[model samples]
Target: GAGVSQSPRYKVAKRGQDVALRCDPISGHVSLFWYQQALGQGPEFLTYFQNEAQLDKSGLPSDRFFAERPEGSVSTLKIQRTQQEDSAVYLCASSLSFSPGMDEQFFGPGTRLTVL
Candidate 1:
């Protein structure tokens, strides 16, 4: 079975440019998560999906950021008008638990975005 996969392992974006990062979760996974990791900092939750529903998005930093899991398997995180502060590793994870408190998520390698 394929594990979680994220595209453009690295990306360099100009300030104010929009960027889209992609993720592919494990087969049959029902839960997905998106996180942002700044240099030397632990990942912070951004959003989460259960199947095709976005169950939680309280962690999204701003209105400029958006994410979607169309069919419960693949997802995308779109950042509009990228900023220097947005430079970080965008990580995607997938799990099987309906309750986030009980799920053990498997993470992707992550897409590193650098804003210049």
Candidate 2:
């Protein structure tokens, strides 16, 4: 099975533009996570999904940010009306456990979004 992978590793977006980042996690992993990492900081949790159900989205910065894992495999993070503050590395992670935080997560390379 493939490890976690993110597409368009780098994205340059104009302010107010909407961007969609993709993530492909390891096969059979039941838990998925989305995070935002700013310069010199650690990844901050954005959302979590178990199977096809979104279990938590408490860490999303605002309503402009949304994530989904519709089929329990591939996931997407969509940012609408992107602001300069939205510039960051968007990372996707997955784990074998049904409970996300309970297990060690394997992270993807991340799609870095640069808001101009």
Top lDDT prediction, candidate number = 1
lDDT of 2 by residue, 1-116 (tens): 67999988999999999999999999888999999999999999999999989999999999999898999889999999999999999999999877525878999999999999
Model 1 per-residue lDDT at 103? 71
Give candidate 1's error at residue 79 in angstroms: 0.1
**Cα lDDT of model 2 overall?**
0.93
Off by over 4 Å in 2: 99-101
Q: Which ranges in model 1 have alpha carbons more than 4 Å from their true place?
A: none
Candidate 2: clashing residue pairs, number: 0
Report the CA-based lDDT of candidate 1 relative to the real structure: 0.95
All models: lDDT?
0.95, 0.93
